[model samples]
Target: MTAASLEGAALTSSPALGVIALGLPAAVLLLAVIWARPGAGAAVRAAASLAVLGAGFALTALALRPAGPSAGPPITPTATLPPATCSPDGGLLRVAASGFAFDPDCLAAHAGEPFRIAFVNEDAGVQHNVAVYEDAAGTRARFVGDPVTGPGTTIYRVGALDAGTYLFRCDLHPQQMRGVLVVA
Candidate 1:
């Protein structure tokens, strides 16, 4: 599905929609607690009202919280690249993946425009691959580049996506080499 569709689906998906549903009751209970404070026997009513509100708050927070892989935005390790064959008005970004690290851990790109990412393996005796992801956390990878095995270089062309945060990393060393890609 398209991004718009994904966003729409996200809005209605399990935890997101559940949180909204639970929040309404919590809000209502909080209002009730406030409103009950000015009535006769205010202290007694306030205490009971507050107790109910507290329970509602707890439940709401639990229901809205994400539980699994989709619980939070994905992440990618920092990366370093070499200079790119950039187009006019399109910037070039070079990320290097060497020694279990990605240099220049962040990049910015314009939305809806094509761009090229050049990958070079400066370290000897190791193979590396680049993968770009939709989320910053790197949980779900959106684009996977070919592995530039051993002391060589490769380039990955990524089309401009909708405005949002993204992730990129070396598949061979995800923990050590990753970074964020911000699309404006």
Candidate 2:
């Protein structure tokens, strides 16, 4: 099934959110303790207790908050190229991945030529890679690249390929991102 669109109050980092987060539990506990007290000079003690509890809660909240998204190479989304040609640009072969699919599912390269395959993944927060195999079943491994998170570019230096059609796919999404590498 396709993903549903998000709705409702969007969460954002702000001092007010922090304050509300840390304030509720601490205030409730403080109020309970103050209400249960039965001794003189209780106001002074309650004031001090609230301060200590607030500080501890604030510190813990700040320490455990999840970090923001990491930085990656800048990429612009591109249309899927039907049978994208493996053309040499600045001494490297170019290919792009967007929307969980390679722009050109069909690519051609020179036989016996060692070239760099620059796989650009443009989907932010998604991971993708280029894997080549001799057979469509992926039984014969030729070249397998480490998965890179998008938006990022990974250069896989493929050794000279023999004249034949080979299978190329994203290892993470094997069936969905399959392609052909035509070495002629």
Candidate 3:
């Protein structure tokens, strides 16, 4: 099955299955404690309580773990290309991504230029997306493409933009995969 389909299945599976899986062991331990010899019952109950406590601690640790930094290359701007001319169809920008970095990290275009960006993800098993924002901090998003797993491609069509320095990055690896879109 495709990776996307598998992820969807995992998300849509019945919650009852998870509940049953978690509760079955506790229930078994409870039954064991109840059926044990009179003096041994207390020890069994204590062991069961410790097991439940350990499980709870493990679940909490998994839920509260902090997401680490991106494993991709560092965010460094390379040379800025000259402004691209808009053709009769539209201006075209090609971006290739692999190992958490985009080729041609800095791009240039004329103001009010209608453009289509062809974003290609070449890294296997990595999910990436292209998003454009009005600011470098990415607080004001202008365009966000659907997340695509490698090897895959997504085309993002952007309307005419005013002269400014826009920010573009992979939403999944924003820290490592980012670039500047300079409109002159």
Candidate 4:
């Protein structure tokens, strides 16, 4: 299997293992405590407590361990831009970025039309860039801009895109900065 599939399998299976590792010992200890006599020797009680503590620690560590590659934050578009007119030469889309968000989070363009974005980063000391993806999840990247630490502007060029809805986001702030590009 490919690496991604393996990762998915691991994520799916680890939780069950973690629950079993944690739950079985706890249940056994609980039953033992309820049934054992109060007068039972101190040695038995101490050993049982130690066993429970050790199992708890081990299970906690296992449950908290990081699973394979983390899928970044989910894509949720917060803004939409008006449709842009295509120039005779091509289309020019203007985007502005400030405070972890992009103005006109949505944009429109014609299919097979070359387009360029005048991306202005208005937030100083914040690094940002635009990346286009095949899906809203930002997993299949079509194009990526050179990251710029603002305040400044950069031109992002995209060749002809087929008719579909594409996703765009700031690579550094995917959770807070995301939008859609619709091609007709």
Tens digits of per-residue lDDT for model 1 on 1-184?
Answer: 3555454344656776666676677668776767666654867767767777687667655554434421223443334332332223355667777665677677667888877877788767677777888765577776788988658887788876777767777776676676777777
Question: What would the TM-scores of all predictions be?
Answer: 0.49, 0.52, 0.57, 0.52
Looking at candidate 2, what is the lDDT of residue 183?
Answer: 81
For model 4, how does the per-residue alpha-carbon lDDT over 92-156 read when each residue is reduced to its tens digit?
A: 88888887788878877778888998999987877889988887678889889988878999898
Against the reference, the lDDT scores of all candidates come to: 0.67, 0.71, 0.70, 0.73
Kindly indicate the candidate among 3 and 4 with the higher TM-score. Answer: 3
Per lDDT, the best of the predicted structures is: 4
Clashes of each: 19, 3, 0, 2
Q: Write the per-residue lDDT of candidate 2 for residues 1-184, one digit (tens) a residue.
A: 1123212222265654666576667777876776577773777776867786777677645544554333233443322323545542343667788887787786667888887788899989988999888887777888999998889998999888888878888887776677788787
Model 3, position 119: C-alpha lDDT score: 87
Question: Of the pair 1 and 3, which is ahead by TM-score?
Answer: 3
Per-residue CA lDDT of model 3 for 1-184, tens digit only, reads 3555444343323443454466557656765666574766667768766777676556534433333333456555433422433223337788888878888676666678778888899988788988888876777898898988899998888878888888888888876787778777
Instruction: State residue 79's C-alpha deviation in candidate 1, in Å.
Output: 16
Candidate 1 lDDT at 81 equals 37
Candidate 4 lDDT for residue 156:
88
Report how far residue 59 has shifted in candidate 3, in Å: 8.0
Off by over 4 Å in 3: 1-90
